[model samples]
Target: MAGILAWFWNERFWLPHNVTWADLQSTEEAAFPQAEDLYLAFPLAFCIFMIRLLFERFIAKPCALGLKVQANGPQKAQPNAILEKVFTAITKQPDEKRLEGLSKQLDWDVRSIQRWFRQRRNQEKPSTLTKFCESMWRFTFYLYIFTYGVRFLKKAPWLWNTRQCWNGYPYQDFGIMFTHHIVTVTLITFSYVTNLTRVGTLTLCLHDAADVVLEAAKMANYCKCQKLSDLLFLTFAIVFIVSRLGIYPLWILNTTLFELYEALGNFPALWVFNILLVILQILHCFWSYLIIKAAYKAIAKGKAGKWNPLHVAKDDRSDIESSSDEEETVPRSKAPHSSISTNGTGGANGTNGYLTGGTCSEEH
Candidate 1:
């Protein structure tokens, strides 16, 4: 009787204060021996951290190493000092006004300036694989905290043991799980159809190139940074296109397959439903194309070079022509002209007339 009373007191008061895996397991073992399976449930925080770490170490790090090699390697050589200068300038002038001033001095277009500003404001703007890995590390740290909160609620004996927890309330958890499953499956399908994995890999390369360009812009008094930012923007645009065109169709196909399986007994009804879904999917594809087209047009305007996927073109010719055109089109105001008029009559006879001469002018 004493042990039972003590256990009840511990569960109500002490359990809440010292909530841990061990404490949760002990409570489950003592109160509901048959419910031992629940005690084995790991915290969501653990899973999130583990996944984040794995992605950072396995995926992001390798990409960063490859980028470093490319940047330093013989094929494309860039001065280290120039790169450092550009990065330093960006870091020092983190504000938009400073960026604008820098852009004007560098002769970069507004679109490039906007892109640089956007990147600076983002919490995780990874230009290198190393930086990406670091960002992932930070993201995982925050994700762990978020998961910890969820796990806390799940593990709380007071909540889980209550009758209110089991009846109909668990539906919310089911809904969340279902949504997560759907999103994950959709993303996976999108990855396969759009070849997003390949694009994502390319993005890492583009990001590195942008970083180098950013660095170059800072060193020289030019709009070179704008070109880098534009490249990054273009990469994002391509990724968006892939997601829309490739992924959406796969999603429709998946949904159709599901409906077919669900309505096996009612073939005609399933056929009609499938047809409607197909129409809706086609509409969705059209809408996605419109959005992608608009975005592509917007980003393309800021491009500095040929922007051909299969070609290596330089921006030098266009840049030189634009610079020359700017010089000719924007007229320089002539320096203010100063005029003076003086008259002297009969200086020898000044004693008699006492003539004086003065000059006056209006200033505008």
Candidate 2:
């Protein structure tokens, strides 16, 4: 184990040439970040989780009520052991062939079976108030984090000039890193170990700013405030694009990829960190494409005067397309050749979408 640890901590890989671990050691006057500090984060996270529960109950729920966010109770499907078994054990949405077999077995028409499935699916969806609370919780966190981040960064030179981030190179400042699981987490963990927290803060701050708008849009959407939702969604798209595509690569990536190299010279771990940033940038581009596509579709629909409240700002990555209420009104006899076509109705509770998170970094 010690041999493996020694090999992994080789100074040549992690630090700049000629800088040994001894050189990076903390003294009484200059205390460095310790890995043990991370232990506090777990307990803090638990506290936050508990706070979320209370916030959702006391704060968000009341706010949702004030906004008049209606919670439509789902219609329960009549009890049927066979269909229930199929829904639970087999598929929520059955294929055409499976539908036919079930139709024959139950001696029921396809339309009735389809309605049951629709009702069944709706039953599984969260209540509109529940979705509102969840979005509200996220909005509260993102807004607070963004506000705090802005305050923190106001005095930090690198907030204005990215190049200043590398003025002291690796030794003069402490920093943070973040990312998804596996590769992203590895990047974050390595970056934190290397004391790269400054850039990490920028990445996190940029991300939370956009999410604040996204969650607000979701909350507005849940309340059926179409105009507010659409406006907020447009704002979210702009923020997402500017932060993820515009500033992230131009400012953050530039500093990390170029300025850092110029300041500290090449190291194996630095190359690893750069590769992870590039990967994150690629993800940004992919999600940006989704946002652009959604925005274009919204524009075209608006021009054509085919505005759908349910579909307003509906990007599946950011929002899921709920099954329409109008579908239930269609006569059972007029049900499409494929019941599948008529089956996708949004649940009674209005959580009609999802949003991906940002930030590819680790903490202090």
Candidate 3:
């Protein structure tokens, strides 16, 4: 396969040159200046090329198979299509009326319309899995570019100097550390008060989980601050979990168990303590909700930042179209209204007279 490809490439670009194959081989030997070196390097280069070709053909090809092709050879479609499809499906329904309308509008069969809806429903959205994988791949590619490309550009002083600042921070700043601490403590406290220790613990765990992702993202840029962030998150998780679940629970259980041996006269205090414990547990649950909400917002904003405005516009358009379709299918009804009137003259004097209102007015 390599020979075939090489032959095609030779014919396409090399054979047109006046140089003969023997002359090219001689030139290659001259450039290396050592037969043993040439022998080793030639086979190594060939093996590397073969591996890369196989990877592109087998792995990358399969992964990209379902992506839409562009006009210029096979390329993935613009990101807007995926976003549009999701929003469109969400805004519109697969009702008989809307499906029939779509069928008539597109000149497709009603069965085909139904099939299309099913296909769309079955088709996966741009899931977190795919997005995460793609981002990692891009980050890996950028790392390579920064590593080797920087070394190559070093020969050109201007280019090297221009990109010198590509290096990221060595350590996370105090601000980030402080924020993490605040968030962890606040979430823990909230969880304890709301009686949602489990949920709060999960929230803390997610913060730790996000550190892994954030570290990977920083690694793409060859940033060393990732370790600091990782350590901070890990510390927060450990401290929060141990304190809330371990230490606190142990203390409560020990007190309650010991109090069982106390006199019945102390029962009222024990009951009050139990009540407070329940309240604390409830507060902890509320705290957990806040933590989850905050984490979700943070991740969502980060992802949203990467999306193109054009993609967002496409999503908005799909939503509008879907909403319009739904409105067309839905039956409209008038809302009931009330009315009132006032007489110019008073009933028995020169005062103004009042007429009973519609629904608001009641008979004596």
Give the number of the best model, judged by lDDT: 2
Tell me the tens digit of each residue's lDDT in model 3 across 288-343. 44433433453566531221211211222111111112212221222221001012
**Model 1 worst lDDT run, 10 consecutive residues:** 355-364
Better of 2 and 3 by lDDT: 2
Which candidate should be chosen as best, given TM-score against the real structure?
Answer: 2
lDDT per residue as tens, model 1, 1-364: 9999666434323221223224323342242211222222344445756776788778756754654411121111122343235555664223445433544554543333333332232213222233335443543443443354345435533233332222221121211111111123333333322212222222122223222322222212112233553454355445444543555345434533463244222323334434554674576466546545544654567534323211111211111101111112221222222001001111223211122111000000
The TM-score between candidate 1 and the true structure equals: 0.24
Candidate 1, residue 110: how far the Cα is off, in Å: 26
Q: How accurate is candidate 1 locally (lDDT)?
A: 0.33
Instruction: Provide TM-scores for the models.
Output: 0.24, 0.78, 0.23
lDDT for model 2 comes to 0.66
Error of 2 at 192 (Å): 1.4
Per-residue lDDT for 1-364 in model 2, tens only?
9999999999899987767777656776554455555556666777778999999999999998998886654556678899889998864567667767876677665656666765665666566677789889988888987888788788788899877766655465543322211113566566666667677778778878888888887777777766777787778888888989998999888988898888888989888888999999998888778776766777876632222222433422222223434245232443335344323222233222111221100000
Off by over 4 Å in 2: 23-26, 169-184, 303-364
